[model samples]
Target chain A: MTLRIYIPCDAAAVSVGADEVADAIRTEISKRKLDATIVRNGTRGMLWLEPLVEIEEAGKRIGFGPIGIEDVPSLFETAAHPKALGDIAEIPYFKSQQRVTFARCGITDPLSVHDYEKLGGLAGLKKAIALTSADIVKMVTDSGLRGRGGAGFPTGIKWNTVAGTTAAQKYIVCNADEGDSGTFADRMLMEGDPFLLIEGMAIAGLAVGATKGFIYIRSEYPHAFAQMNRAIEIAYTKKILGANVLGSGKTFDLETRLGAGAYICGEETSLLESLEGRRGQVRAKPPLPALQGLFGKPTVINNVLSFAAVPTILAEGSAYYQEFGIGRSRGTMPIQLAGNIKQGGLIERAFGFSLKEIIEVYGGGTYTGRPVRAVQVGGPLGAYWPTHLFDTPFGYEEFAAKGGMIGHGGIVVFDDSVDLARQARFAMEFCAIESCGKCTPCRIGSTRGMETIDKIIKGEDVANNIELVRDLSEVMRDGSLCALGGLTPMPVLSALDHFPEDFTPAHQAAAE
Target chain B: MSQLPRKPTQKTEAGAYDLELVREIAASMKGLDGPLIPILHALNDRFGYVDDTAIPVVANVLNLSRAEVHGVVSFYHDFRHEPAKRHVLKICRAEACQSMGAEKLFAEVAAALGDSAQVTLEPVYCLGNCALSPSAMIDGKLYGRVSKEKALAEVRK
Candidate 1:
C-alpha cells in the first residue's frame, strides 16, 4: 500500500514555503519510486511547524516538520528508517496546544468533503438540523462560546435575542472585515476551511430564524474572497446551502459582499453600512443590530471566528468544549503570534495559558533574537504589556483585569529597540486615519490625541500634554460611538503608563 | 481681491452618468445614515474615483453636497482621486514590521529605487501579515518577511 502524507497549502503555510516543501516531497518520492500519497492540509496553528508534513499508516497520523524544501530528500530517506521521523506527539509545541476549534485543521484536506466528513466536519450541522431552533440556541448557550470579535459577548444571548424578535425580514451577517493589524485567523479559516464557516452560518440562520446571511469580507483578502465565493457555489451545488439544505425543508441563503479596505468596517454597524452600499460608519447602540440592522430588520451579527466555532461546539457537545478553558472563558482561542518574533504563527490554546509562555517559549523571543521589552496583546486596539506583566493569563477576564483584552487573540511582540512613544503616536494616527467620522470622539479625538502625543514627544510641556492624553483617552473611551474610538486609547495609554521614560523629552534628547 | 478662480462649473446630463446605477447603489444604501466611505468606494469601483461627471448623480441619489462627496472621496487612503497604477507597492511601517528590521529594509528599498521613503516610495502601515514579519503589499497581494532581494523581484515582476 502507498503511504499517504498531507501538508498545508494555505496561504499562511505557503508564505512560509509549504509549497516548496510539498514539491520537494513529490520529487523525493518519485526519485525513490516510493509508493506514497501526499495530501495538503490546512495549518495546525503551530505555525512554527510550517511545511509541516503528516503521514498516515496503520490507523495513525504522524507529523514532522518546520521542514523546508531543502530537507525533503533527507526526510524521505529518513522516513524509510525504523525510527520513522520522531513521533509528532512528542513535539512540545504540538503536545501543549488544546486544539478544539482547530482540531482537524492540519489533519484533513481543506476542500475535500470526504476528508471533512471522516474528520467530523458537518456532523454538527447534521445534528443541528435534527434539533429545534430553540434547542440549537440552547446548545450553543450551554457550550459557553463567546464572540471572538473582541467584544466577548455570549453567542447564545445574541442568538436568543435575534431568534425571539419577530420581523418581516431578518439577517445573519458574518463580519469578515478583519482589518486588525495583527490578525489573520479569519482569513486563514475562510481560505483553508471555508465550508465550516458556511455550515456555522447556516446553523446560525436556523437558530436565529433568519433566512438570509451575508458575509462582509474585506477586499484586501482577494484570495480568501475568491475561495469563499467558490466554496459557496460548491455548497449550493451540493445542496449544502440555499433552500431546503440537506433536505431538511428549511430555506437559508448566503452571499458574500466585499468591503473596499476600510478598517472601521470591522465594526458590526459599520460593516452593516458597507454591506448596504454606503460608507462604513459606526451607529449608536441600544437599538442594537440584533433589533434593527441591515435594511431595518433584526440581524444577528457575529465575527467569522465566532460563527466558525459554532460547528465545533455542536459536533463535540457543549460540555466537551466548555471543559477546555478556565473561569468565564471556555473553548480554545486561535491566538495569532506575530511581529518581531522567532516562532511567529497561530497558537490555539485554552484560556489559562500565561502570556509569558506564548511570548518567551512559543515565540522563542524576538526575531532579532534580542531581549523582548514589550508585547501588545490583542490587535492594535489592545494594550501594550511591559515585560513585568507577562505573567498575566490569556483568558478574556484575566486580560481585562490586567487592563488588556484578548482582542481577537492577536499578540504583537516587540523588542527592546522599539520606542513606546512612537508606538503610542502610531495608534492615534491609525485611529485618525481610519475613523468613520460619524462621531465626535473618534473623528476629532484621534487627531487631537495624536497632536498631544506629538507635543509630549517633542518635550513641549511634557507633563501637561501627558495629562491631556490621559484625559482625551478617557473621553474617547466613555463618549465614543464604537470600539474604534473607545479601544484606540488602550495601546496609547498602556504604552504611556508602562514606559513613561520613553515619552520624556530629556530622555529622547539624551538618547539622540 | 481676485476671487479664487470661481472653481469651474460642472456639466450634467441625463443618462450620461448612469443615474439608474447610482440610484440602485444608493437605494441599496438607504438606511445607513452618513454612509460617505461606502458610497465613495462604490462610486469609485463603478465609475473610477468620483469624477466631476459622476458627482451630480452621486449627490442627487445619496442626498449629499458635491463637496461632501468630494471630501469623502479624498479622505480615505483606499480611495484615490485618480485611477490607480497597474501596480501599487505598499511597504509595511507598523510596529511589528519596524521591529523586524523593516527600517533597514525600507532604506534598502528606497536606495534600490533611488527615491525617498516619504515621496516616491509608497509606504503603508500594517497589512495584517504581522506573524510573517516585514510584510509588503505588491499590486494588492501581500508578501511577508520581505527582504531587499524579494522586494526587488516582486516590484520588478
Candidate 2:
C-alpha cells in the first residue's frame, strides 16, 4: 500500500521553506525506493505550523509542522517526531474553525480537479447548472450573502442588477487584487483551492446573464497566478468551464489578468480601468459597477471570498449558510490573523465573535510575549482598537458602529511597545501614496493630514494641530469620492481616540 | 541674482534600448485585451526599467500618443523609470510589519547596506504575507521573519 503524504505548496508555506521540505521528501523517497504519494496541498491557515506536513494513516491524516529538510527522513520512520501534532482535525486551532470558503484548502491537491470534486467541490455549480438563472440569483439573494470585500454590499443584489440588465455582453470580475497588508485569505483560496474560485465564478456567470469573466489578480501573488491559471485550464478540460459549461449549453469563460502594483486597482472602477489597459484611476459612480462596468457592460465585480462563498451557498442551500452568522452579516468569514500574533493564521468563524476572543483566544496573544496594546482590524484603512475596546463584535455593522471595520477580515495584532502616533502618521502616508489622484480629499488631504500629525508629534501647537487633523479627516471622510479617501479617517481617528497619550509631550518625554 | 541655465534638459539617456526587441515584445502581446500595461510590464521585465526611448516605439506600435504610454509607465510604482541595481530589496512598511518591529529592522538594513551601488532598498506597503510579519522581498522572492541578520545575509549574497 502506498502512503499519502500532504505537504503545502501555498506561497505562505513556501516562504517558510515548504518547497525545500517537499524536495527533501522526494529525494529521500527516490533514494529509498519507497512507494509514497506526495500531495502538494494548500496551507491549513495554521501559519505558525507551516511547512505543515500531513500523512494519511488508516483513513486519518496526522500532522507535523514547522518541518524542515532534516525532519523529512525522521517523518517516514515514525509520526512521533518532535514537530508532530498527532491528527490534524484534533488540533485546537483548526478544530475550532467553521471553514466554508476554505473547506478544501490544505486538504487536497490544488491543481487536481479529481481531488476537488471528491471533497464536495462542484456540488454548488452542479446545482447552479440545473436551476433557472432567476432561481440562482434568488438563491444567493435569499442566502443573505453580502460582499465580503470590505464594502459589505449585498452580493445577491449586485448579481440581480446584472441579471436584469439588458446587454450584449457582461463580465464577472473577481477582484483578486487583495492589496491589504494583513490579508492573504484570497491568495490562500486561489492557491489552495483554485477550482473553488473557478466554480464560484462559473455559478456567478449562471446567476447573471454574463458569459465572460476576468480575475484581476495582483502581480505580487506569483503562486496564486500560476495555480489559478492551471486550475482554469484543468476546469476547461473537464467541461467545468468553456462554451458549454457542464454540457448545459451555457457559455462562461474567464481568464486571469495581472495587476501592476497599483493598490487603488482593488477598487472596482479602478480595477475596470486597469483591466482596459489604462491607468487605475477611479471612475465616477451613479453608473454603479452592476450597471456599467468592465468595458461599459453590466459586470458583477466581487471579492475572492464573496465569489468563493457562492458554491457552498448553492450546494448546501441558503438556509444552512444563513443560519451560522449573526445580525445582518451571514455565513463565515476567513479572518486572517497576522502581525505580532503568536498563533498567526486564518480563522474562519461566525460574525458575532468579539475582538477580544479573536485576539486572546485564537491568536494566543502577541508574538513578542508582551502585553497586547492595540490591534488593527480590517486592512490599512481599519481602526486601531486598544485593549479596552476588545469587546466589539466582528459583525460589519457592529464593527462600523464602534468606528472599526472587518475589512477583508484581516486582524493585525500589536504589542505594548507600539506608538499609535506613528500608526496614525502611517495611515495618512499610505492613503497619500495609494490614492488614485482622482479625488482631492484622498490625494492632497492625506499629505496634509500627515503634516498635521507630524506637528502634533513634534509638540508644536499640539492642541491646534490635533484640531486641524480632526478637521482634515472630517473633510476627507465626507468629501472624498471613494473609500480610499473616505474611510482612511477610521484608522487615524481611532488611533487618536484610543492612544491619545502617544501624541502628548509628556508621553514622548517619558519614552525618551 | 539671475542664474540663467535656460532649460534643464530632462532627457534621459536612451540609446541602450533595443528598438527591435521593443517592437517584438509589443507585437507579441498585441492580442491581449489591454495590451499596453502588459507590454510595458514585459518590457520592464526584460530590461531592468522601461527605457524612455521605448515609449515612442510602444506608442507607435499601439498607435497611441507618446504621452499616453509614458503616463502608464509613470503611474504604476512597479514600473521603474531607471534601471534597478544588481539587486532590489523591498521591506514591508505596512502596519502588520510595523507591529513586528519592521521599522527597526528596516533602519538596520538601510544602515548596513548604506550607499551600496549594487543594492537598492525600497519600502512596500504590503506583500500579503502578514502571517509572518517583518517580511522582505529580495529580487521578487519573499522571506518571512526578516531579522536584521537574515536581511544582511540576503543583501550580502
Candidate 3:
C-alpha cells in the first residue's frame, strides 16, 4: 500500500524553509525505502507551524508541523506508527477557527482539478449556471459578503449594478494586485488555488452578463502570475474556462494582465487607467465601474478574496456561508497575519474573532518574543491600534467604529522597539513616492508632509510644524483624488494620537 | 556648429507604413511637452526603455539638446536611458532593510560580484516589503524576507 504525505510550499512557508523540509522528507522516505508519495500542498495558513506536513491514510489527513529538515527522521518514524505523531485535529491552531474561503486550501492538491472537485470546488459554479443573473446576485447579497480588497463595500450591490447594466461589452475584473506590505493572502490563493479565482470570475461574468474577464495582477507577484497563467491554460484544456464552460453554452474568457508596479493602480478606476495604457491616475466616479468601466462599458471588478469566496457562497448556499460571522459582517475572511509576529500566515476565520486572539494567541505575540506594543490592522493605510484597543473584533463595522478599516484583512504587529514618529514619517514618505501626481493634495501635499515631519523630528520650532502636519493631513484627506492620499493620513494621525512621546523632541525639557 | 540629424522631409511611401507610422507619432510629440519625462515614458512603453537610438530620435523630435535630454533621462530613476538586460534586479536599500541586516546581504552580494550598491547593483529605495524585510526585485518579481545566502542562491538559479 502506498502512503501519501503532504507538505506546504507556499511562499510564506518557503520563506521559512518549507522547501528544505519537503526535500528532507523526500530524501528520508527514499533512504528508508518507505512506500510513500510526497505531495507539495499549499500552506494551512497556520504559518507559525510552517513546513506543516500532513499524512494521508484511511481517508483522513493527519497534520504535524513547524518541522525543519532535522525533523525528517522523526517524521518517518511517526509515519510508521501513526499514533506517535499525536492527533492532528486536536491542534489548538487548527481547532480554534472556522475556515470557509480557505476550506480547500491545505487539504486539496492546489493545482489538481480532480482533488478540488472531490473537495467541493466548482460545485458553486455548477449551481450558479442553473440560476438567473438576478438570483445569483441575490444569493451573494444575502450572504452579506463585502469586498475584501481594503474597502468593505458590499459585493452583492456592486454585482447587482453591473448585472442591471445594459452593455454589449461588459467585463469582470479580478483585482489580484495585492500590494499590501504584510499581506500575501491574495498571492497565496492565486498560487495555491488559481482555479478558484478563475471559477469565481466566471461566476461573476455569468451573473453580470460579462463574456470577458481580466485579472490585473501586480508585477511583483511573478509566481502568482505564472501559476494563474498555467492554471488558466489548464482550465481551458479542462473546459473549466473558455467558450461554453462545463458545456452550459455560457462563454467567459479570462486573461491575466500584469501591472507595472504602481501602488495607485490597485484602486479600481486607477487600475482601469493603467489597463487602458495611460497613467494610473484616479478617475472621477458617478459612473462607477458598474455603470461604465473598462473602455466605458459595464464592468464588475472585485478583489481576489471576494471573488474566491463566491463559489462557496453559491455551492454551500448563502445561509450556510452567512451563518459563520458575527452581526453585519458575514462569512470567513482569510486574515493575513504578518510582520513582527511569531506565528504568521493566512488565518481564515469569521468576523467577531478579536484582534488579541489573532496577534497574541495565534501569532504567539511578537517574533522577538517581546510583548506587541502596537498593531497596524489592514495595510499601509490601516490604523495603528495600541495594546489597549486589541480587543476590537475583526469586523468592518467594529473596526470602523474604532476608526479603522479592515483593509485587506492584514494585521502587522509591531514591538516596543518601533518608533511611532518614524512610522508616521514613513506613511507620508510612502504616499509621496506612490501618489500618481494627477491630484495636487496627494502629489505635493505628501512631499510637504514629509518636510514638516523632518522639521518636527529635528526639534526646530516643533509646535507650529506639528500643527502644519495636521493641517496638511486634513487637506490631503479632503482634497485628494482617491484613498491613496485620503487614507495616508490615517496611520500618521493614529500614530501621533497613540504615541505622542515618540514625536516629541529628544532635547525637550521635562514638564512639571 | 554641430549639424543635427537629418529630419524626415516627407512621409514614407507604402510597404513601410508601420515604421513610418511610429516615426510620425514620435515626430508629432516633438518639443511640445515641458520635459522629457512624458516622452521618455511614452517611448519606453513603445520599446520597453529608451534605447541608444531613441535618445537622438527623441532629441530630434523635441529639437532639444542631446546632452539636455540625456541629463533629464539620468535625473529620474524611472527613466532608464539604456536598455535593461533581459532581467532587471533591484535590491531594497531602504532603512527597513538596513535595520533588518540587509547591509550585510548588500555587502555579500557586492563582494561576490565586484560591485557595490551604487555602481552595478541597483539599490532601490523600497519595494514595499518592509514588513517582510530584506526585500529584492528580480525581473520585477518581489522576493521578501531574504538573506544573503538566500539571495545568492536565487541569483545563481
Candidate 4:
C-alpha cells in the first residue's frame, strides 16, 4: 500500500516555496524507497501554514505544515512530529469555514477527473443537463446567489435578463480579471478547483442559451492560466465541455483570454473590449451588457465566484444554498483575510459575521501584535472602518449603510501605526494610474485629489485642504463614469471620517 | 499556418531586428481572435521589451496600424520599452502589504538598491500574497515576508 501525500500547487503556496517542499518529500521518499504517491492539491486557504502537507492515515488526513525540506523525514517516520496537526478537518480554521464554492479545493487533485468525481464534482452539471433553461435560471434565482464580484448584483437576475433577450449569438463571459489588491479567491478557485468553474460556466451557458464562453484572466496569474488551460483540455477530453457535454448533445465550450495588466479590465464592458483586442476602456450604460454585450449580442457576464457557485446551487438544490446567510446576501463569501493579520487566509462564511469576529477571532489579530487601528473590508476602493465600527455585520448592505462595502470580501487589516492620510492619497494615486481616461472626474480628479491629500499631509492649508479633498471626492463619486471613479472616494472619505488625527501633522480638527 | 506577410529588407537603424522571429511569434497565433496582445507579450518575453521595429511588423501581420500597436505598448505599465535591468524587484505597494511594514521595507530596499546597476526597483499594487505581507518578486519569482537583506541578496545575486 502506498502512502498518499497532498501538497498544494496554489500560486500563493508556490510563492512561499511549496514546490521546494514537494521536491524534498519526493527525494526523501525515493531515498528510502518508500511506497508513496505525492498529489499536488489546491490550497486549503490556511495560507499562513502553506506548503501544508497532509498524509492519509486511517481514513482521515493528518496535516503537517509551514513545512520545510528538513521536516519531511520525520513526517514519514511518525504522526507525532512537531509540526503534526491531527486530522486536518478538525483544525479550527478548516472546521469553521462554510466552503460552498471552495469545498473541493485542497481536498482533490485539480487535474484528476477521478478525484473530482469521488468528491461529487460533476453532480451540478449532471443535474443541470437534465433541467430546462428556464428551470436552471429559476433555480439560480431561487438560490438568492449574487455576483461575488464587487458589485454584488443578483446573478440569476443577470442570467434571466440574458435568457429573455433574443440574439443571434449570445455569450457567457467570466470576469477572471481579479485585479483587486488583497483578493485572490478567483485565482484560488481557478487554480485549485478548475473543474468546478468549468461546470459552473457550462451550467450558465445552458441557463442563458449561450453556445460559447470566455474567461478573461489577468496575465499576472500565469499559474492559473496554465492550470485552467490544462483543465479545459481535460474537461473537453472527458466530454464535460465540447460539442456533446456528457453526451447531452448540447454544444458549449470556452477558452481563456489573458488581460494585459489593466486594472480597469476587471469591469465587464472593459473586459469585453479587451477580449475583442482593443484598449480596455469603459463603455456607456444603456444597452446594458445583459441586452447587448460582447460583439453586440446578449451576454451573461459574471465573476468567477458567481459562476463557480452555480454548480453547488444546481447540485444541492437552491433551498440548500438559500438556507445560509442573512438579508439578501445569500450563500457563502470566500473572504480573503490579508495584510498585517497574524492568521491570514481564506474564510468562506455565511454573510452575517461581524468585522471584529472576522478580524480578531479568525484572523488572530495583527502580525505586529499592535492594536488594530482600522480594517479595509474590500479592495483599494473599499472604505477603512475604524475599530469602533467593528461590530458592523459582513452583509453587503450592512457594510454599505456604515460607509463601507464588502467588495469581493477582501479584508486587509492595518495596525495603529498606519497613516490614514497616506492611504487616502494612495487610493487617488491608484485611480489616477489605472483609470481608463474615459471620464474627467476619475481622470483629473484623482490626480487633483492626490495633490489635496499631499497638502493635507504636509499641514499646508490644513482646514481648507480637508474640505477641498472632501468636495473633490464628492464630485468624483457623483460625476464619474463607473465604479472606478465612483467608489474611489469610499476609502478616501472613510479614512478622512474615521482617522482625522492622521490627516495632518498639526492634529487639530477644522472649525467647521 | 499560413505564412505571415514579412519583408526581410524591413530593417531598423539599430540593425538588431529579427523579422523572422517577429513574424514567427505573430504567425504562431494566426487563428486567435485577437493575437495582438499575446504576440506583444511573446515578443516582449523573447526580446525583454517590445522593440519599435517589431511593432510595425506585429501591426502589419495583425492588419493594425503601427500607431495602434504602439498605443497598446505604451498603455500598459508592465510592457517596458527597453530591456529591464538584470533584476526586477516588484515590491507590493498595496494596503495589505503596507499593513505589514511593506512601506518601510520598500524604503529600505530602494535605499539598498540605490546606484546598483543590476537591480531595478518597481512598485506593484498587489501580488495576491497579502497573508504573507511585505512580499517581493525578484527576477519573476515571488518571495514573501521579504526583509531588506533577503531582497538585496536576491537582487544582487
lDDT of each: 0.79, 0.88, 0.76, 0.87
lDDT of 2 at A449: 96
Ranking by TM-score: 2, 4, 1, 3
Maximum-lDDT candidate: 2
Which residue pairs clash within candidate 4?
Answer: none
Off by over 4 Å in 4: A507-512, B1-15
User: DockQ of all candidates, in order?
Assistant: 0.21, 0.32, 0.09, 0.42
lDDT of 4 by residue, B1-157 (tens): 1121121122222225588889987877766756677677767667777888888888888889989988888877667788777778988888888888888899988887787788879888777788888888887687788888988887776
Candidate 1, residue A114: Cα displacement in angstroms equals: 1.1
Per-residue lDDT tens digits for candidate 3, residues A154-210, read 999999999987877999888987776667788888877878898899999989899
**Quality class of the docking in candidate 2, CAPRI style:** acceptable
Which stretches of candidate 1 lie above 4 Å from their native place?
A: A2-5, A19-38, A53-90, B1-76, B114-121
Name the runs in model 2 displaced over 4 angstroms.
Answer: B1-16
lDDT of 1 by residue, A144-201 (tens): 9999999999999999999999998899999998877678889878877888999999
Stronger candidate by DockQ (1 vs 4) = 4
Q: Which residues of candidate 3, in runs, are more than 4 Å off? A: A20-33, A58-64, A67-74, A77-87, A507-512, B1-157
Q: Which pairs clash in the backbone of model 1?
A: A5-A39, A6-A39, A7-A41, A278-B38, A279-B35, A279-B37, A279-B38
Instruction: Mark the 10 consecutive residues where model 4 chain A has the least summed lDDT.
Output: A503-512
Candidate closest to the true structure, highest DockQ: 4
State the displacement of the C-alpha of residue A417, model 1, in Å, after optimal TM-score superposition.
0.8
